[model samples]
Target chain A: MKFSVMVNEGPYNHQASDSAYHFTKAVLQAGHEVFRVFFYHDGVNNGTRLTTPPQDDRNVVARWSELAVEHKVDLVVCVAAAQRRGIADADEAKRNGKNADNIAEGFRISGLGQLIEAGIVSDRLVEFGD
Target chain B: MPTVKKMMYVNRRAPHGTGYALEGLEVVLIGTAFEQEVCMAFIGDGVYQIMQGQDTRAAGMKNFSPTYKALGDYDVTRLYVEQESLSERGLSVDDLMPLTYEDEDDDWAEKPSVQVIVRKELSQIMAAQDVLFNF
Candidate 1:
């Protein structure tokens, strides 16, 4: 089965991101295709490379990046939501006249149309949020 | 042609208090561009989103309640408001904004977009959807 995941909350503060990551990993391990993982609202924080958790704790952002690199999952952060929350990619940061970008590897900034497209193409669109 | 999926955006939060209602509306607006059969459901505190007389000037927020009016132009006509939810919140249909749309197939006759249904009915409607986006 093909699946699309939506993370609607930021990492650490809520378990939504962790649950979404584990669900995506389990889906891949089960041999199902992940159409995309669309991040919205505070969830866009997951795409920022600036995240620095305690060394002993699991790095949520890095885990998502590694998942994308290893499984080739499409991780998309909604541009509008990201801009509102200060999570910007290199191109977005340049366009918005920001000095730096913080978007992590294996993620792309995009419009909400990507989320709609995921709902259209994926067999299941799963959301994790408060 | 892309398949037309029945996509429903479920709102369970009140507006202004959290960013969910506003961001959820953004998704609905963007989804309409995909030309899918889209609908919105307002249950629990979400019913307050479409309530009339929402003023955010004092709160310093961009009162986006009026954006719900523009959904019809995007061919998004279904706004399901749960009857029980309203009663639970001490509100009625009269408290909601009179959202309407012109039916292109029916000689542009203006029709009501908000449908107040029982929870049971809303459940069936949810079950019929190809995708359900909860906010």
Candidate 2:
């Protein structure tokens, strides 16, 4: 089966990001196709590279970035939501005349259309958030 | 193009109070570009999004109520309102805007787009969805 995941809350604030990550890992282990993972609403915060969690805690955003790299999964963050929350890629930063980009590795800034498309094409779309 | 899945937007938050309602709608509106079965369910406090005569000027926010009126143009016509939710909030179907869509398959006939369903029925509809988006 194919699965698409949506994370709607930021890291640490809610268990949503953690739950989504574990669920995604399980899906991959089960030999399911991870079509796409979309970050929307407050979830876009997961795409920022500037977060530095303490050594005692798990780096939620870093974990997701590593997962994307290892599994070759497409991690998409909504551009509109990202812009509102100040999470941007290098190209987005350049386009918007910003000095820096904060988008984490293995995540791409895109429109909500990607989320919709993921829903349409994937066999299952699982949402984790408040 | 891939096979289309039946998608549902499970909206539970009230408008304006949070980013869920407005941002969720933005996704649904853009989703109209895909030829897939998409339906929106207004449950809990989400029913307020369709409430009629909304005046956000005092709140100093841009009123997005008019966008709901344009949903039909994008073929996003099905809006399931939980009947119990409405009553719980001391509201009725009369409190919501009368949204309609032109049925092109039926000679461009106009028909009501909002469908009021009981909790039991709504659950069944939810179970049938291939994809569910909630914010």
Candidate 3:
């Protein structure tokens, strides 16, 4: 079964993103395809490359980046929400005339339409939020 | 096939204190463009979102009660209120704003949108959904 995961809250402050990450991992491990993982609302904060957790703590942002690299999972962050929260990739930063870009590796910034598309195409769309 | 997926929106938060209820409604509104089979269930504190005569003026928040009335115009019907959630909050159908939709198939007759359901039945609705939006 193809599964689409949605995380609606920021990491650490809320366990939403973390729970989504684990669920996505388990889905992949169970031989199920993860259609996409769309980050919306405060969940876009998990895509910032600048976040540096302590040495022992889990790096939520880096874990997602690694998931993208290892599993080739599609990690999408909502562009409108990301813009308001200051998360932009290189292309978006250049287009919007912003000085700095903080989008972590493996995550792409897109519109809410991508989220809708994921729901349309995937068999199951699971959401994690407060 | 009609390509109409079973979609369920499970709301479990209050109207204010956060953007969940408002944004959740916006998602449902946008989702109507797909013409999917969508249903919304109010559980836990989420039932408060339908409380009638909600006055958010004191908190400087936008009163969004009017939008629920407009949902039927957009064909975003099937609003379900959990009986347990309402009873736990000491509320009943009288405390809620009645929502209705026009059935064009049935000569455009008006029909009530909000369906008061028990928690178990609401769970069955949730399990049957292809896409579950929890906000």
Candidate of highest DockQ: 1
Candidate 2: list runs displaced more than 4 Å: none
Ranking by TM-score: 1, 2, 3
TM-score of each: 0.98, 0.95, 0.88
Question: What does chain B score (TM) in every candidate?
Answer: 0.97, 0.96, 0.94
Interface Cα RMSD, each model: 0.5, 1.3, 1.4
Q: Rate the local accuracy (lDDT) of all candidates.
A: 0.95, 0.91, 0.89
Could you tell me how far off, in angstroms, the CA of residue A21 lies in candidate 3 after the best superposition?
Answer: 2.0
Error of 1 at A11 (Å): 0.4
In terms of TM-score, the best-performing candidate is 1
Candidate 1 C-alpha error for residue B84, in Å: 0.3
State the lDDT of candidate 1 residue by residue for B20-124, as single tens digits.
Answer: 999999999888878989899999999999999999999999999999999998998999999999999899999999999999999999999999999999999
Worst 10 residues of 3 chain A by lDDT: A111-120
* Model 1 ranges with Cα > 4 A deviation: none
Residues B27-129, model 2: lDDT tens digits: 8888888878989999999999999999999999878888998888889889999999999999998999999889899997988889999999999999998
Question: TM-score of model 3 relative to the true fold?
Answer: 0.88
For candidate 3, list the clashing residue pairs, or say none: none
| Candidate 1 pairs with clashing backbones | none
